[model samples]
Target chain A: MGRHEFLESVAVADCAVEIEGDDLDDLFATAARALAEVMVDPATVPATVERSLELTAPSLDLLLYDWLSELIYVKDSEQLVFPVVEVHVTGGSPCRLTARLAGGPIDRTTTALRADAKAVTFHQFVLEPRERGWRARVVIDI
Target chain B: MKTLPVGDCVWEIPPGEKPGMRVPARIYASEALLARMDEGVFDQVTNVACLPGIVRAALCMPDGHWGYGFPIGGVAAFRADTGVISPGGIGFDINCGMRVLRTSLTEAEVRPKLAQLVDALFAAVPSGVGSKGFVRLSGDEFDEVMREGARWCVRRGYGWPEDLDATEGGGCLPGADPDQVSQRAVTRGRDQLGTLGSGNHYLEVQVVPPGGIHDPRVAKVFGIEQPGQILVMLHCGSRGFGHQIGTDYLRRFDQVMRGYGIVVRDRELACAPFGSPEGRAYFGAMLAAANSAFANRQLITHRVREVMGRVFGRDPRDLGLGVIYDVCHNTAKLERHTVDGEPLELVVHRKGATRSFGPGAPDVPAAYREVGQPVIIGGSMETGSALLVGTAHAMTETFGSTAHGAGRSMSRTQAKRRVWGEALIKQLGERGIVVRAASKSGVAEEAGFAYKDLGEVVDVVDRLDISRRVVSLVPIGNIKG
Candidate 1:
């Protein structure tokens, strides 16, 4: 019901939502789930391939973009859809992130495309941490 | 359902007509034609009214549509002292427009040779995305193209110098300073000249209908006919060169406006003062792009003439294939117009609109001064294209501008979802129109139903006497990119 709270409370853990676990992990996992939902139907993904990935970006906005774009690359090439369970944001030169994801072969009929994104554009995009949780503000290039 | 008469075909919104409008808006559509506009059309028109330096009104042409900063069929001439130039105004494919050619061949003689002629044209002209042409240029040669426009191609024997007479700005804007263009733009443009890039760009063959003939004597001189005479029309622009030029300038202008303390309601409407360094830089680059587009079309015309000759087994000279007119749709030109009583040098930005200067206008070419400048409007593949001439009415109404084409009624996604590409192709083929496209999906995106009926748009403009209808050309064959 509360869009901001829902976006903030999303977490990551063990490649799936840890409903009764740490807030940060659950938040990252939820963000990944949100991304996966937009890309394709998570229910249809076989979850056969276990993938571990890391990314670094200049800002939280860039971090979200890098994360989403990287996942999109994997979706296009590997035909894998990943629903995150755990995510750890570690500080580095830019900023580093580790995530666990799940996905499998793509089936177009059963999966509805949520958006027609040509490419991620650099418009008025921003990512920042809020008092309650992490928040990302971005406009998808459609 | 409500119409506030502005003047002639123009209608005013008067500030609070719609919500979120910082200023009033105007639409250049007759009451009959305005009724057929898409429901969301006013929304997009009002959205533009909220932009910065939008001047007296946010004007929409008969062919209006929802687009990024401004609607596709919208035009707003921002004040030179304060206005902004949105990339949305020029569009992603900068300077994309139409070039019409007249030929000696009548419909009867050309109809039989349609297949061979289409084949020749298809093979001769490179189409589709990433499609390259037989002609290629290096960075230096490309720079020459940016500076000389169609003349560069003519000097190389692509076409005759006379062809320049029928082109807007004589096929090259005078103030093209190549130094303002970026190296990346040069690189992208170097190989793309004379090539028809993908999506909505096309080379079409049509038969001229007899009845709507204007200046039959002159038409006779040009070899245009009454019911069925074959003609060639090319719709394209500067391609990657123009894209890169617009991109480079849009970003530069976006940042440059900060120095001038100028702010717009929308970032897409980013701009700098007309006299500022960035504004001059953008103008120079835009001109260079316009030149590249002119040269590209000139080369394509030459190839088309060659192919017509090869297919007809007669010299193209005898075939009477010559340029009727070449014009750009999205561009900003510097011209002198009387503001109050004294002539003032003004920067006129005509986006999705064509310059329709009437007879006796000094700016119009000498050959066409008697009949006025020929304005070619390329319609949907199913609907035929129209030939129009400038009218005296347009001079005071809309800065001598008229609607460019049948504006899109729906987005590509909606069109694709509703219509299948192959089915649309077959439908066209059944209607005696042959179409060749690079991507099937792309074709679906451009389905005739995706846009307003061009016939209606042209009719409104003609009825209003903004531009006089000269000819309606029904397509026989088309190759789309």
Candidate 2:
């Protein structure tokens, strides 16, 4: 199944995405994929290198913001795009995120960067339980 | 949602209009422009009015639009002793601003070679997403740039020392602590000193069309001697460095706001009191990022001169290329202002507004103090831009602030759906404007129609006596990222 889908949000001047999964861990993984898709064409980037990161925030919503923001920071600073993602969330008063990102250095010859996703905004950001599973929504500042 | 007419081209949202609003919110816009403004702008402005220690009313310029927290083109001042500082107020692109340089050559002299000149510029100036810059600074050198700004560029032989005199705050804001900036931000900015990033950033070659000078006296003071004279306008900012700083601080403030007993309506408006340790640290880091921006623009200016020199077969100085002025649109500066019939020191936050000090103001450069500071308004590539001067009226009403640009009326996605990049390129070509862009999608996103009419926006400010138009420049060529 597809990890995530794009959503229309006029409230933000930039793009938004909705990720669906069976649990919190799945939701984080899907959210990471959605973030990567916003920056570059997913099919073009090969999962040649793997990197792992851990982040902690006070709540699930903030954990999502931190996770996505870290991706942007990695892309801009290291010029790499992640196509494969694995996320695990440990639920507590202080939420912690462990993510494994797999991608390669941006080769301008083949990889076409669609948008420069500057940061992950907190505007209307949400991660919650749904009737069927877990759902997350994030608006990116492009 | 109710608005009361205050004065010519002005409307006010009374303090009571919104719960928690401590002061009134005023907007400068004509009837037509007001109607087109997004309803969210009112909410954002009112929300800003509720911030702790905000002085006067939260003011939105004619170009105001709904942004993340504060509306773009929003200006507000707060008492330094009690106010809170929010990175959102200054925006992610710290010191994102405009700079204009005039050349002795005229439109007629350069029209034939416009394509070649644009190509040269496009190559000389690195642009677009993931683009690296020409200057690769060592860690120590990068720290110096954070502390010194344009002055560092001048010392490195990238710009003339005199250029600093023509810049806002002399191109460097004091209290920049390089140690406050994170290592990640430093790494991101190390190779991006002279780069132009994507999304609404561009370097345009423009001309002052015949009879475009609005005020002869002001134009003379601005070094604009004749109509049809060529000028270069570059719009960019602190790049990755500023974005990282803003991102880092927003998260930090969001966590600490609870500790300070501060509650903001929006998380994006997260802040800490000015006297708090977190607030001082963010301010210091923000200044460092702002300095990096000044140095970035200065380096680009140097590159522009180098390219022009090569293309025209003359020395850059021989071509009479000199900076008119460089001003920031997004910043928070510690300034003194008169409020409630008393002089007070405050921190003025201009999100998407420019500082427009009036004639005889101490901040205005000595050469142009009699006329006033130049307020650069960059419009779309297809339309044109305007040069305006600050007025005394602005100082009293708006903390000496003015609109930055023709605010976006359509989202980037909507704009792309409405216009085809190839077709727009052809249309601009027919209008005698040459454009070189790295991405076709970016070109489509920045279609001229996406923004409100600059003429109407500028007119509102002019009628309100916030700023007076000096000259209008029509674009002949542009290089977009």
Candidate 3:
């Protein structure tokens, strides 16, 4: 299992989060979950819809960016708020990843959107492996 | 980095202060603003000075803050023949800008109906996360919007002919090629034409309060002569479409920059030669996104006019709902400017800055050419926003650029921790400002305490003669995205 927490000082105008996981897959899954919460309260969203995303990137850093960006596209295009995120990752020169996000169209009456995470910012973006696990920091433009 | 006071409200860092810097970096700010500026702004602005083919100096306006690549309120110009273009310099929301409209109604007339008007607008305009727009567009029609911008909206009866004339560049940036934009961008943006995306975006109904007119002469020329005159100010951008375009190019540029032998200290500042195939694609795609933003604001304007007409029992035209001006805060354009007494074409990037073309410049609309292009600078809804006019001094000092707003002085998380949105709403209501936000948390994040003093920032430029003050607008009604 992985965990994430919001950072207060990393970004002044947007939301920043730091995630920790036991491995690459856990790290990516944690990142997705963190990204999801930044936009809306996940607890209020029901896991009624399913979306599958697959992408490849030259670096793990870019792989994470692409995954989060793809989700933003889907969320904006379909007007869905994902509460559940599942990510599978394979580390290599060209990183590969697939995600399954479960959510549905936002019912404004029931949901309180915190912010519109417009895009993932590369400012101070970091992804690294630690002795015990992995850690990544992401700044999302709200 | 060591800096010297170059002029009143201006500080300069020589090229020797940083490795790879080709020119000096200048900060257009007051002594107090300079002292409080975050270190990241200094670092980022100096890094911008290192880019290949930079002209004169990289500039940080008074409202500057740290951003992805260039600082917010940053501007830089590059040689058209040899320089490069990076999405980082233009920001995720392409042409994310400000627009102001003048109305004949007075504060006295609007005050009684302020709550109803705000609520109607809040319901009519889609906002917040995962918000979709009312006007749906097919793939082909969306493409036309990219090419024709606000003109297409008028052609579709969403706007009037005169609206285009008040818009910057007639609301259509040239060289927008639909083919250059990606499918994902179109999918994300096709339906978002009239939406105000969350995160500091808003539509405010304001009035020129007594003593708010800083330059009475220019205010009269700009259709804001009276203190009680009402105005509608909208802040938004291209939405998901531009965000997708910026993301796509940032990744693409990172991959191809090494091939072009271009190196930037930060990967976020990735770039390729302006003349390269890669660069050409992004430029066209960016212009398309910029045009979409123009059309988006125009669509929102149409909705606002409809709501106003419905509320006040008069046609919008009869109410004198005319666009005063529309301006972009995030953009990169190729324009001809003189450098060191030589005239040359340059690609000027304004990330969180506005173009302040002074009086008599050919680009200024003929109606405003003698008075200067109107610049709308939005502050927090609780504090007041301002209307200003450009000056020739800006043309010489900052590539005709000026600050966009009072940049956030506190982090969103900190702001949320400090105040409860539920309480902030009541606080604002007591102050006589009606606010309707999609989310309470969003409102808290935008509390005036989290932002710098806009008056001080405006004073910096006013004193420097970059952008002169015209009128200050106090919000009577606001709908936060």
Candidate 4:
């Protein structure tokens, strides 16, 4: 299934989660797609544009926040919406991520941002590895 | 979704729910109301429970909603001895609140010209994103306004001392130190004073509903409807200035937090010791922002009074457009409250909450001491709002606090998708409620359905004994950003 379908399928009341390929790259890619699920018609976000992302952090959870925040910046500033199509996770204890993103012609019709999350708060934020893959539980400040 | 019985209407969040919790979170809601609560709200409150320096418990009100740091309906008291003040707790729009005005005009006179009055108000009130005002000020002048609060507006002839009497702390906190405020805040605030910034901010015309008041004497004192008497209520805040102050403080707090060994549950909850230099600076700047917000509302009142006079062909004073009560929803005030029977100076941070000083409280104005401080809760314009009075329970339970409004239920995107602004406006107009909006999008963003039911929210407060209902108000006209 496409990233959009995965996001829609995993939907919780206020959040959604997804598990993808067995690498850090794919994990970060899926995470971006999850956030995209909130902002627009995720299906419409194409892999037309490719961009490289790099983030280093002291903690794996903080790394995840920086990753999501990076994608948000790209979406908000560059108007590029992407369903993270690729991923690669590296580094120890505190992880680093490298990924590929795609999208184009940002949907101008999306007037109200899904949620203007104020910040990525540390409250109840956790990143854990499950039997199937990796999972993250982070609360966005809204 | 599980409930643990606490007092009459309180529910506890058992300590083991989240391992990191410093204290069990409690909610003030009836069983019936709790059943309908969105599960995300529970999760959010749980997150709040994990924050550091969270003394007592992370409390959520009946109006609780998912928010940045603390739930919109959340309340937590930190220990002054070893506590922190989070900007996320007070919200970005510091001191965003409501001001209710009592008018002599009966519902009879306002009904005829409600539409025109609403339109006039819409035009006069600057709203929407990046909305500016005609009363521009230089940076230096803006600094004075920030320091003085509503007194600045009153000094400029926007209002009188009587208005101050009805406002919290006479519309200005003494700790406001303009020098603590950054230049960016001053720039954003200079021209935004006297303007109603957008997103849930509005000017509403209301009529006290029939048979809504339990006390005829109290109703008469508050100028309640004899079936159709009219009142004006406005909700807004310090605008760009407040937003900038919040942003600046959050960064400063984040940088210095480690030095103070203040480990907050959330970075959004970043704070310094109340007595620390950083904390004092934030308090000073926050006070300035609160004062600026007070001045903003004060000026809006003057403008509304002007428009009312012109629209009705009667002087506003003659029409009894007197200030009833103005209260702040987001602020941290240094006050002495009895904690376990010992009086101590504490920095009370109220976010998405309003102070409801009970009758006879020394902090309350002498004029209102007998009746209790009026608590004006502004519901979304298309929904019903309420007027309540502080109860002794407030002082004992929630630190003299109560919910501010119908907390948001849906995200703006969801609301925009589900409700069209044009259709919503038409529906309201058909219902005899005239609405004037800065933009169609703004209207949709603030649709009543976008919020939790105010009736339900008010019921929780009344049932919980935090505040007692004084009257219910039905909207007649609306002016929104």
Candidate 5:
């Protein structure tokens, strides 16, 4: 299992979160959940709707960055708030990722939103491994 | 970094203070403001000084704070022929700005219905996360909006012709090649037009108390004619369309800058020469997004008018609900300015800053030429906002720019922890401000205590003669996203 928490004082007018996971797949999946939490409580989303995503990036870090950005893109283009994220990553210099997402259309009446996050920023972005697990810090422009 | 007092409300960090700095950096702030700024402000502004082809000096206004690459309130200019353009300098929300509308009705007449008006606005103008606006545009229509800006809105009956006159750049930036805009960007922004996105975006109904008029003569010219006059002020930006474009260009710049032999202190400051193919494409796309933002504000203005008209049972024009001014922050422009008495065409970037062209500049509208351009500074919901006029001094001192808002002193998470939304709403209601919001967390995140005192920020710019205060407006009702 992976975990995430919001950090204060990192961004003047945005959200910064730290996530930890058991492995690469866990980290990527947890990152999606954390990004979704920035907007609404995932527990309220019910995981009733499902979607799939596939992406390839030159590097693992860029892979994670684009994965989070894809969530924002989906929120805007598809008008979906994904609460559940499952990930499978293949190791290589060019990383490959396939994600399964579950959520539904955004309705103000059903889900209480916290903020309209603009983009996932590269300001002080860090994704690295600690002694026992992996740790990532991301800043989101709200 | 060593900083010395260089001028009135001005501080300078010399190039010798850091390696690779092409020019010194300047910050417009009083001693108190400097003390309150984060230590990161020095690092961020100094990092900006190291960028290629930077001109005169890198500048951070009184409201400066740490941003992705360029600090908020950051201003820098580069020579067009030899310079670079970075998406970080313009911000993710392209053309994020302020718009003010003046009403002929008095506060006494509107006070009884303030709550109703706020509620109506909250309902009519779609706001908050994932709330789509009423607009539905096809691909062709949306492209027209990308090129025509607010003019498209007016042609489709969203606004009046005269409204464009009061808008900056007449509500459009020319040479907007929609072909340069990405299909993904269009998909994100097409239907989002007219939405007031959450996180500090808000629409407020305010009043000009008799004693709050600072410049009586100029106030009358800009439509703040009578005491107790009610006004509407909104703060928002281009939404997801601009975000996608900015994200797209920023990533591309990061990948291409090395090929151009440009090295930036931060990845977010990545750039290519303004003459390069990459840069030109980005400029075109950015202009398109900026145009979309102008149209977004205009359409929102239409919604405000409709809501106000229904509440008052009068024609919007009959209520004298005309645009006073619309000014954008987080933008870049090509302008002619003189440095050392030498005329130069420069690409000026203003992120979390406002352009304050002087009275005689051709850019200032005919109606405001004598008093200078109107600069609107939005404050916290509790402290209120102000309408100022640009000064000749700003043109010479700070590249025709000034501070945009009261800089945040605390982050949103900290504010939410300190103040519960429901209680804050109750407390504000007791103080006569009617509050309507999409979510309680949204309200708490924007707690007034999280922001710096608006008066102090205004006083610094005022004392520097950059922009002079004209009228102060306190919020009577607010629709927060």
Candidate 6:
């Protein structure tokens, strides 16, 4: 576990975020939490349902993009919000990821929907190893 | 970073200014507007000039601003046989556009009941984050919507057949193959057909003020004969469906780019050759999403008409609720344009820009052929909007394209920090503009100061003769997602 914070980008109309962790797996998990926080208050989402996803992408940056995009798609199409997200990454080159997202159905009374992130844009998108941890910058198209 | 003055309100970066740029990059802006623009716009437009098969130049409109790859208000044309198609060039919101409907009622007649009408409209149309629409489609029917676009809605009684005539491309782009659309995209689109998704999308009730009409003859042709005439303008597009398509294609194109031996300065500009298998597939899928957007707007129009009828106590027809025009700001259309005095088929990509075909163009509807295509430019709620008609100069200089809106001058975060949503709402209310939105923070994010002035942007295009102003619209009420 590490830290994730929202950043600012003059190039886009929506939110930009920076996530860091001890390794690739940790960074992915923290990034998911950051995305969840963007949509609603994580404290309000009840972790009553669980969804598991296996995704693959050509590169690490794209893997993060696909992960976030899948979460957004699930949030919109299934009407579910995830409060807890776990990611496990293995192998190399074309990386593989297995993620488990736990949350409940969205209810206006409990969930204060903040923003609907349409997709993760590749504009200035980066995922790289930094001193002490792995750091990534992603701009979410809202 | 260097540019030379090419014409009044125009600046150009020569082809050799960048190492791989095949054509010049042009920006249409007054000196004041250009001074306010972010430097990223220059980088993005110049990068676009380097794309494969880009013809003549990569052009930015007066309202241009930095975007992902192509600047917002960016326009370019590529040779049909040699050029490539990129999702970034068309944008995530496929056919994200503006539709304006005129009514016989005047502002004076609706002023007292403005709030009530706004409430009715807000209730009728599903809006805000993750909101679903009243129309739920089965998987099979959803496929039909992807194929037939607004025509599907007309067949289902959502809109009248004549409404399509006022829409660009007749409210549907041909060559849409439903099978090319992914199941995930379809699933996301199924319940969101008539929804106005969040972030700058809105439905507004506007009035033509006494001084708003710029040209009396053109205004009359556009159905704006008298001051205080009420009109409804809606800005929206394909919801989750287009987002999914854009996401899916960007990733696929990035992976395939290496095989095509194509390299781009930005990964977001990923593309495939127009004749390539990947390019054709994405084009088909993009058209499906474009059609989905047309149907979404048509259904929303139907909802607006219903609300108006209820509020006015008259049939929508009797109320004179007829569509003046619907034009998409984000799209890539294959059309014939003359390059170097030779007629050639080209794929024109307009991201955050509008098509402004001049009078007598075959694509213009017969009713408007003598006046040219009506271009709808939606400004922020506080500043109001404008209607302009294309000129022959637009076709010759910009491939029949023009500015889409008063582009953003500040980031959302900056806007939110500078303006309190509640206070801004109060200010607008004091000015006789009723504003309703899902979130106050969202309202603040789109504060009037966050965007460039519409008047200046319109003035530049008008002075340049790219698009001539017809009328201006002052907002009376608006609903934002």
Cα-based lDDT at residue A101, candidate 4: 68
Flag the better candidate by DockQ, 1 or 2: 2
| Candidate 6's TM-score on the B chain | 0.99
Residue ranges of candidate 5 with Cα displaced over 4 Å: none
TM-score of 6: 0.98
Q: Give the RMSD in angstroms, all C-alphas superposed, for model 3.
A: 1.1
Q: Which segments of candidate 6 are over 4 A away from where they belong?
A: none
lDDT (10s digit) by residue, model 4, range B201-286:
78889987777676566667676647667889999888767876776787678778899766665566777877788888888899
**By DockQ thresholds, what CAPRI class is model 6?**
medium
- Top candidate, metric DockQ: 3
Query: Candidate 2 residues B199-233, lDDT tens each?
Result: 77899999998899989999988889889899999
Least accurate 10 contiguous residues by lDDT in model 1 chain B:
B214-223
What is candidate 1's DockQ? 0.06
lDDT of 1 by residue, B1-481 (tens): 2558867677887777655566777888877767766654576567667655555567778987544445566666665665555565665456778998888788788777777777778778876533455787877788788889999988989998889988888887888989998776666557667777655678999887667575565565345766677788998887766766665665566666778776554454567766777888788888888888898899999999888888888898888788888888888776666654655555666667888888888678887888788888888788778888888877766677888888776655566679887898898888878887655666776777877788888988887777878777888898876
Writing each residue's lDDT as its tens digit, candidate 3 over B1-481 gives 8989988988999999999999999999999899888888999999899898899999999999877788889999999899999898999999999999999999999999999999999999988887888898888899999999999999999999999999989999999988989998998889888999988999999999899998888898888878999999999999999999998898899889999888887667888889999999999999999999999999999999999999999999999999999999999999889999999899999999999999998689988999899998999988989999999988988999898998888888888999998899999999999999998999999999999999998999899999999999989888987
Reproduced native contacts, each prediction: 0.00, 0.32, 0.76, 0.06, 0.70, 0.48
lDDT values for all models:
0.69, 0.87, 0.90, 0.74, 0.90, 0.89
Angstrom error of the Cα, residue B420, model 6: value is 2.7
DockQ, computed on Cα atoms, for candidate 3: 0.78
**Residue pairs of candidate 3 with colliding backbone atoms:** none
| Model 1, span A1-142: residue lDDT tens | 1122112111100011111213334445655666565444467666777888888866544555567555644543344577544677765568777887766655543443332221222333344455665544333322
Q: Write the per-residue lDDT of candidate 6 for residues B1-481, one digit (tens) a residue.
A: 8988988999999988888898999999999999998887898899899999999999999999878878899999999899999999988889999999999999989998999999999888877766899998888899899899999999999999999999999998999987778899989878998988878889999999888988999889888898889999999999899999998899899889889989988888999999999999999999999999999999999999999999999999998999999999989999899999999899999999999999998679888899899999999988899999998989999999999999999888788789987898899999999998866677888888989999999999999888999999989898988
Q: Which candidate, 2 or 6, has the higher TM-score?
A: 6
